[model samples]
Target: MNILTAMSSRLTVPFLDLKSQYRQHQAAFDGAMGAVIAEAAFAGGPWVERFEAEFAAYCGTTYAVGVANGTVALWMVLLAMGIGPGDEVITVPSSFIATAEAISFCGAKPVFVDIQEADCNMDPGLLKAAISSRTKAIIPVHLFGHPANMEAILAIAQEHGLPVVEDAAQAHGARYDGKMAGSMGLAGCFSFHPVKNLGAFGEAGAVITNDGELAQKLQRLRDHGQFEKYQHEVIGWNGRMDGLQAAVLSTKLPFLEERNAQRRQRAGWYFEQLGGIPDLVLPASLPEVEHAWHQFPVRIPCRDAVFAAMQGAGIGCSIHYPVPIHRQKAYHFLGLPEGSFPVAERCSREFLSLPIFPELTEEQVRTVTRVLKLWITRNHRVKNIAFSGKLAV
Candidate 1:
């Protein structure tokens, strides 16, 4: 059968392949989880400590604080940095709103900056223009598993005496210039959302840093501000990562590098297959960075039409962010116009994420690419017919 007929025979192909991942690691995962349950160490216990240490070592950092989730991870980092009311944090507009929401939750303003068209990470060139005396820190997101331009961002932060925080929620096991994403800044935040490269059964997250003092502060911050029981010293939040999630994460940690490697291989196939398609822009890999491929998003002209075509063809495809954060209703007070952040706005319209989990087969990759190319060609034909007297595609 042709690619379209083959896809149409199926009902729904998932955008992610979580079940395959779990099946591959079931024995070890079950044993670790059982151990956590048997110990009855549900919160802030030995398992949590063990996972924190292991994750810290994995990230090449001195300390890692397990938290409730990625959002809390960002919140705890911002709080630890002493960012508060009237302060502003600079970040890109192309991220999950959690990056901006974390700043707003801390009673600080999230100053929006545009992104580089290449990787959708923050454009460091625009960062300098956005900084003010109230700018307390820079939270650069490693969007879609690609590392931000950290070297330039780090240099700018160091020159201005600003602390750099990494929003590494989607970039587990991703590295920049031989250093891991979470270790590239003063503090790096990670998420164990089930969809990420290194995921937990449920919600979980952590903060990693080389600064010992900051590490202790985050520990206190997550646990009611008390190093000891019932001695509340400062305002804090209940953001501790449960031992159960820690156990799951620990079981999954050792395989992170291998899984990310598989993802890269899959991404390579997608690029190789679809890179030359007309009006389609494949994500670029930079020389200094290793992509985790948490998402293998492609930018195509008339993205919505292509999305509808893929869905009609029974291939699951989705957009990473249909609306840029700055343009969202919650952030409308920023009063940014339609073309305010051109790169981010354009990207939101054009980018669509494809199925790229490690477990996906080469056949599946070919299937997706074939469907996408066919759809794009058909759409181009329709456009040409409507505009000109001749048929095209």
Candidate 2:
């Protein structure tokens, strides 16, 4: 019997255990939901307003507008900023498609840029060349809870007279140079999907901004552009966040900091255990930034084989993205070829997201590392033996 087969019977770890998180604060969640039910505020009402205020304060922003989901959060921000046909938005291709989709949906072109090899975030050096005469805005995504190089990105934006909207979907409490991820830009967008750090029971999202006029415009844009009942001021969509999701998010917000700390702790354990592996490349963090550790993705040789081996050992592993957005069929019109963004394309092929969550225990982490190490060791030995055989022949 192999190491993987033997370990499979003794241990099993999931990528995320939301049920355990729910059980940790069941009463608070239930009571909050019950209150919303009692008031019958099923749509946008007091609960949604309460969460918006609390979230804004937490992000150190003057205002936050609740919306249906993170995609729409980005979409709404672009719309409110007057981004439309003939405009262009600059962002990296090493992110979820939603980042670029939001721009495409707004009738603007998404100009792709490569990311830094070390941190897998946007490379500020490349940002300047991508800006064109039609460039209207910049959307810097805080990918995998690691804040991007905002100081440099912002300086360039200011020089070009452009607005920046932070994509903080996976970086709820991440900080950069003592500033919150979403607070540094003109407006920051967030998502409250069940898997996020501060998630609701279902889809929810918000935009935080220091500009009050922008806040009011977002509020109107989310609700049919209504200035008053039966009074439509501008064309809009049904993007309002439901009251139930808002209540659930509010209940989960207070505990987000604690959970983020736990995630960091888990990340440290991964570094301590896997750092010495010669062929493994661990995730990198920038100086003066606090990473939220949303996903601990590491690059390794023979990633597909190792991933399958880990699965056989009862460990839940995933790939954040196996394909870059530029290569996707949906974006074929962009005319970007295979090597447009080499770093992102390489990462998409080799990156593996191991099991990581607040509820994951130290022992579980140990099991995961052990399985990975065993696979690497065995694969190396087999390759060496084959090389020797070839020499003898």
Name the runs in model 2 displaced over 4 angstroms: 384-393
Per-candidate TM equals 0.96, 0.96
lDDT of each: 0.89, 0.91
Model 1 lDDT tens row, 200-318 = 99999999999999999999999999999999999887899999999989888999999999999999999789867778989978999999999988998778867876776678898
> What lDDT does candidate 1 reach at residue 387?
28
Model 1 clash tally, residue pairs: 0
lDDT of 2 by residue, 1-393 (tens): 666767789879998898987798899889999999999998899999999999999999999999999999999999999999999999989899999999999999999889998689999999999999999999999999999999999999999999999999999999999899999999999999998888889999999999999998999999999969879999988899999999999888898999999999999999999987878999997787999999999998667777877887799999878899899999999999999999999999889999889999999999899888877777776754532111111
**Predicted structure 2, TM vs. truth:** 0.96
After TM-score superposition, the amount by which residue 254's alpha carbon in candidate 1 deviates from its true location, in angstroms, is 0.5
